[model samples]
Target chain A: MSDHVVSRRRLLRTGLGTIAASTVAGCKVLDGLSAPDHRLRHFMERANDLTMAMQRGVLDRDALAQEFAPVDIRQPQRPNGVTDPQDADYVAHRNARFANYRLEVGGLVHRPLSLSLADLRQMPTRRQITRHDCVEGWSCIAEWAGVPLWHVLDRAMVHTSARYVLFHCFDTIERSLSGAIRYYETIDLVDARHPQTLLAWGMNGAPLPVPNGAPLRVRVERQLGYKMAKYVRAIELVDDFSGIGRGRGGYWEDRGYEWYAGI
Target chain B: MSRNTPPGPLVRRHTRVTRVTHWIWALSLFFLLLTGLQIFNAHPVLYWGDQSGFGFDNTVLRIGAVDDRGVVELFGWRAGGMGVLGYSGGAVRAFPPWATIPSGTDLATGRVIHFFFAWVFVVTLLVWAVGALLSGHLVRDLVMDRHHWRGLARDVRDHVRGRFRHAARYGPLQRLSYGLVLFVLFPMMILTGLAMSPGVNAALPWLSEGLGGRQSARTLHFVLAAGLLGFFVVHMVMVVLAGPLNEMRAIVTGWYRADAQEAGDV
Candidate 1:
């Protein structure tokens, strides 16, 4: 027989085998419209169930990742992609060793003020040992000392209308759709008030290094390392984060990172 | 004996569009598996590194430069300028000689291809989904009855014994596997894929946390893709065993004739 003919004959036999299997497989227990599409749907349905369950588990209030010991700190954190802030203003800030650095706290706040580094140093401070979990499959712990962000917000006297605290940093990993140079991150009021959260100025009991967010940075211990905005130059208290980049919460959010980095 | 033949002529089994889509999806999945394995050589699960036994190392050439136009361009350039590797998208390269899959190396090209093809795969799946849902094929063909659940043990016994002759149309195990792949694994892939996207991650911070951050998502993506690959292998093996032509036709044309009297006849 010709190859085509042989193949066709084989097809008939295999088809028969399959049909017998299908019948004994108990598909007739259902109604009887066995088709390839039906099989595909079955797969899709399974995947959907998994996705939704994961979503709920992650977002659910009870689920929490385990915390580690304070002594587990990695000596030197090899900064992931972006190290230094590329913006001219940030470069100028670094040039002066951030002596003249002033963090602008405005936007929906009752008192808009640009507090200098010296002024920030005089505020009430808190220190805590925390870990930095990189999405790159590495983890590092460090002792950080900085003023509580709540203290800064208290001094700024944020408006009651404020719902989101936006951190405007000085580094640019890439560019947002709006062509902004600096990277930004934000947090809701709950995380904003978490005692572990602070505007960290020192790491490992030393003044923050330049590669690290020198001068000042936000330390949100409850979340992943990325949420801890480095080289924080401004804190904008906004009522809504929807007007932000791509209507997502953070700079990286537009690029596909989850808005909640609470690992 | 003639009076025992109560049924009419066997009917045509599969629709044209259905057959085409099935073959296309199957072939695409095959290509995807091969490329995926090669790409994953960067991070081989067991004994994958420079000192490993498999001893294959693939180089990823990432190209990024500030062009004369003052615009920074990113694209994959050939490694050693050997020009053996072809560039597909922005700032990516795939060099052969992969060991186990290298971990912590750039799979940006793999990622891009994976993402691009994912959309195609998803679109195809969606088409199949919509067709099934509209035609009510799924309700009749897929939904397992109590008897099917009861027969699960027997099916397992049959499958293990290489007696899967009855699994042609839609067996309970097959249905269950398909269900999990479609609903559980596919969505996991999509969500994890989306979770890894910096753009998406930045927008949906919750996803990063949910999927254990961007890197974690990448890790999960690889693991899940591996699972799919396993499924594909077994599927192909079954096709081979069940008689390739018959299996292909059944999936394509959706017709098969099985006689009780001619059980063991050639």
Candidate 2:
């Protein structure tokens, strides 16, 4: 009977030994799970790619996000990230009511042009109420009125070499000894030209609030809220975003958020 | 391991599919729970509607730390989730660092780990469903009948008395709990999770609508996770009560000790 108990203890000892061995080895493995270029992180990034591919392939590219009624726009759209910009230039533009503001369209475009806020408001417009899903497991529904993003890109005639559209914002999301990093975002042509992609200038029938991107923001309806670059001042077409902020394609992406937040 | 050949006190209690999926579940759930906590700490509050932000009263739960002070509010009830939740070490994040992946406040890393395991969990669950159907394990073992209900009282009494018997394959309460986990809890977790995805909502609008919007789905997901944790705690206690070695060996090696009369009867 005692020997039987002894055997069980031996089994436990062996089990503990295996766990100890794994922990010793797994310390490095687990600690590096989020580190860039590590094996576990490699798999995680690969999984992110898988998620993006599966969503892109399985779902219709132009499927519209659920649109709620006007009554569904409860309370107000919750502003997030850099809600207010203290940048001297942005303050001057705000002070001037953005009368001199120009939406600069450059990079891989056959006809690089800069248009005033009035010029953009004159383009093709669409209004829809959609939910804003934040990366932090919260959501807000709001009615947005804006010109279709494709209209502007079409006017500029994005060059065939262009593969992605980058949005430059007026808000500085971060600043330190490394200097101020203004907000920016990138989207593939598919999403950039999606029928619902809008350069929104108004929210809930009013001019966009200072807290909610003010003059303009890009609304990529099919993605998380971060994809919508707020406080927009410029749009650039590019074949690659490798030369942009930290080369991750967006301000948040550079800080470790996934570039593709469709989920 | 054949049904009829091993005519002694040893019986094959777990099939290969069951054992493999069980381990997969154990590993995935561990990471899912911890990493899930990490994600939760990012917002640290849950609401029950389509929208949530400042100046609203829809908050169902909130946890935070202020000036090294930790607090938790559920509905209107308040408590200090000092060490394990709101505050840990010097961090003022929800759910302590020890409970999170990366052991620091890294939402991006937590998200990556969460999504990877989420895919693993999803694919494995699909594979398990098909495999379970083909193997008769779902029907033969998991399905409960009048016979199972009849033994409920006796099984309850035996468990309370610490008098385990090898009278039947599984106890009625055990089957019920396991059935709920397999058929109900897990499915709800997946559905709620999918509902929170804006991408999925475009494809499956009815899912979020049925669940009362995306934020509601997030709320349900957290509640369901809590249910799973409850089930795990009860499961562990039962394992210890019924005999840990025998249970562990049954799951790990598919071999469990049974009484002489019960042997070869299965």
Candidate 3:
């Protein structure tokens, strides 16, 4: 028999055996479709990159997320992720009404500074009724008032080498024997500088509620809810994110969510 | 007509582009539907208007479970069907494991696969449309004229009676159905999908707003999927009724062997 020749009996046996094995495993057989090193998964990730690039290229970088009229802000913003994080630092800050709280700004910046809540409130501000799109497919519209992130970045004198802005939050979304992991998120400079991107201090004309990130949160309006890190404690500018959580740029991203949540 | 007559000489039916894109669409739709259900399992409620939360009241559909009961509420009407929707095989999930890709609550994986095939769907549609137009395949085969509909009543009457006019050219009814699906439903699905995207909404705010709301657009997407599923079922029945082997050969090999005497009219 030639090296390339296949016997009919052998082919039938192999095909039947494979079918029987698949039947035995049942649904778990599809687990390999999402396995880390699966070839199909690589294609999917590559397609994600293509989608990201296409969106980035096609959409005007400055185009603002849809802002609704006051009448449209019918409901209070729904709180997601960790509400009332029990971190001691956060509790103390809450106890004092965030009076002594300071949002630390550092990393790849010319000026590193820690500013009080009052400092953020005093910056040039914008109030817009915007829809909060959740990754789970529900949406909520609410009014958010805050200083554009660019203003804070300019004040900190972000370095020219910086490519991404990371938001370090006080809330821990996952806890395990290894230790609690605080939620964090990252956005590119384009989104960081977008007009609607806010380091929000207020919601629906009221002081930010503890249930809704309290004193402050970063809102990347063009992205999904997870991209907007709540309980934002510090901001860091970075050129590379590979050293961050699982190197995927956000807490949820580390667990296989898309880093670019725009879509 | 004689019962024992052989099929006539094979004739080229589906163009290479048509055959290739058709299979690609079949594969993409298969993956997209399964993964899409998985994503829906994340939040299985459908509402109207721009928002959904504690404040929104227009709960059009809600698939959920309690203890051992699975509940599926649609437009205020409710039903219980375990092992299908809501409760499935000892767990609480909107859609059963067998119906979803990864067959679990892996929204992350579901999202990855859904979006991956979604792009494939979009790209293939563009290629198929542009090629069909350039090759005149759209005009010569899929498009219908007044003359094609002249025998419409007879065609439907025959179809309902298990009789078929398995011709080389598409019947007026077939063209109508395909037209509705390819031109209307497909575009609606793509647009509805985009309307739900916050990024696309930024660039085309009117897309979601004009659809009444983002949530409404989501509902429409689901409804349209059901429509596509209906079409697939009817399409399969027609394929089987019209002669599976000939239909399969037409698609797979670009040649169909059918009785020339029967198919000669069209």
Candidate 4:
């Protein structure tokens, strides 16, 4: 090998060596060893600088997103995040083509009920064209049609004590210690009651594709793309977001991302 | 070696002004990163964070003012920070405190500060760029020769293996990072930033075209900031490996002491 190759090989070996050591150490004392604080701080400082620049001159905060004609919605709207459901229950639901799919709505409601996809589709619906602004710096526009979330809550008779609506997704983002398949997101009642908040079953005027949250998903127009959780299975009414994933209130929340991805 | 030849320790690398501007650049870069992330509270990078509310405008409305929406609305197209979005006065008032642009906080203020500091950054950068041209810093310190390009692999290995600190000057990682910061990041910030100006935007619409439009100028700014954040992380990591105090002192004082003496003079 050339000197460069040898040196690089040595460096890669050393990096792997550190990773191995840290992995072993992680098994023993996973909590105490805060990785050296340097990188995160540096990352933070850079994030701050970018904010100052944009805040100062570059951005138009009120700039409206490009609105599209009503007829231009794309067929087969894309599915975001995890495309395939790995959990056995989700797999079963997918296999059965969601024939038995039902959304259990409970918690802080006077009349909690398990409504099937058929039941959901039979209700009154609304359609809106909006843009999906991804945190990864991409945007796509689509028209979503679905049953208004408030209408569903009304049928279930959500109690006055309820303040937030939590959507339990069918996808297992991370396995919890209790061995229960954990999946869910929460939105406050103000947004929950917005006319645009819907349990969408169709995208671009067609039956929602399997990849694009086939049976059901949410369309929270005001928030960024991630907040519109896909493969939704249940909607739980709650008073607070506490006891939710790290209390930041979403799956990605536990992983150091923000909870409210509102644009 | 001839007796009359100056030792490696005596060589002058970066000038004083160049070093000072670099430090300022570093500090401003860091502050921008933190506040930017916090402001992007689309995901609320932290608790109590909100997207679009931490700017100066939002900060001013928190002083117990009631029914100021009319005044806010009256400010009109040129008021607050950005222009109006046609929301009813109720929605305008309902905007969380963080979204209100202070009376003095307009794109103009941002432009003045950005243009002013940017000129400072640019003038210093120009001097450095000229220095690079004169000294062949781009050819020698930056654009690695084809033969040395192959050495990058081993340099990365040595860097990861902890032998990089022993190498003279910055290692391959440091050199590449510095090169990108100076060449890529700085230029992008300047160009995209200038593209946001209406005068500049009209004169050269294509400049902002890559980033969608002038409205997206902020988004591009944030994207570039993200790149800088990545550079900062790697930069600090290398500094830690190289020994922070010694490295910092060398950059600050323009003199490497320690083994910088005759101990391992190349």
* DockQ for each model: 0.05, 0.63, 0.67, 0.01
Clashing residue pairs, candidate 3?
none
What would the DockQ be for model 4?
A: 0.01
Candidate 1 lDDT score relative to the true structure: 0.59
Model 1, C-alpha of A131: deviation from truth (Å): 4.6
Q: How many residue pairs clash in each candidate?
A: 67, 0, 0, 29
Q: Rank all candidate structures by their DockQ, best first, as comma-separated numbers.
A: 3, 2, 1, 4
How high is the CA lDDT of each candidate model? 0.59, 0.85, 0.86, 0.58
Better-scoring candidate (lDDT), 1 or 2:
2
RMSD of 4: 20.5
**Can you give the lDDT of residue A214 in candidate 2?**
86
Residue A5 accuracy (lDDT) in model 1: 75
**Candidate 2 lDDT for residue B55:** 60
lDDT of 2 by residue, A162-200 (tens): 999999989988886899999999999999988889999
Q: Per-residue alpha-carbon lDDT of model 4 for B205-249, expressed as tens digits?
A: 466566654435545665687688788788778667665544555
Task: Mark the 10 consecutive residues where model 4 chain B has the least summed lDDT.
Answer: B43-52
Model 3 interface CAPRI class: medium
Interface RMSD of 2: 1.9
For the predicted complex of model 3, DockQ is 0.67
Interface RMSD of 4: 16.7
